[model samples]
Target: MIQPTKDEIRGWLSEARNELRSERFRRRLLEHELCSAKRALGNAVLKGQINVPIEKLGELVLKLQKESETEEADM
Candidate 1:
């Protein structure tokens, strides 16, 4: 196996960090979008535009909020 030089290792680490930062940024954007979509759905339900049960929608929103929190914590 060929051994990597210190500079090579540093470069790899830098790349990894950049990639991770990019991924986190993307996730945050997506999370915001998810929240927006949830709000829109909730509004639609409230306005009688959707036929979903209120309790079911609340539960689904709660579940999604918890999942989003968990993901944020993980990051």
Candidate 2:
């Protein structure tokens, strides 16, 4: 079996690190999009614009609002 040289190993490690960084950035972007969608859904429910069960929608809206408030407080 041929062993990798030091430079080859370093290049592989650098590539791995770059891939991890890209994955993390993509995950963060997706998370932001999901949060936005959830908030929009919650708002629609609260406004009677969506056709979901009222009780469940109310609970979801309240939960989303609470989370938003908490995030604001943290910021």
Best candidate per lDDT, number?
1
lDDT, candidate 2, 1-75, per-residue tens: 999999999999999999999998997899799989988886886688888986876787798789879978987
Weakest ten-residue segment in model 2 by summed lDDT: 53-62
Model 1 residue 5 CA deviation in Å: 1.1
Tens digit of per-residue lDDT, candidate 1, span 1-55 = 9999999999999999999999989988997997799789879988999899768
lDDT of 2 at 29: 100
Instruction: List candidate 2 segments past 4 Å from native.
Output: 55-75
lDDT of each: 0.90, 0.87
Residue 65 in model 1: lDDT: 79
Model 2 residue 35 CA deviation in Å: 0.4
lDDT of 2 at 47: 85
The TM-score, computed over Cα atoms with residue i paired to residue i, of candidate 2 is 0.71
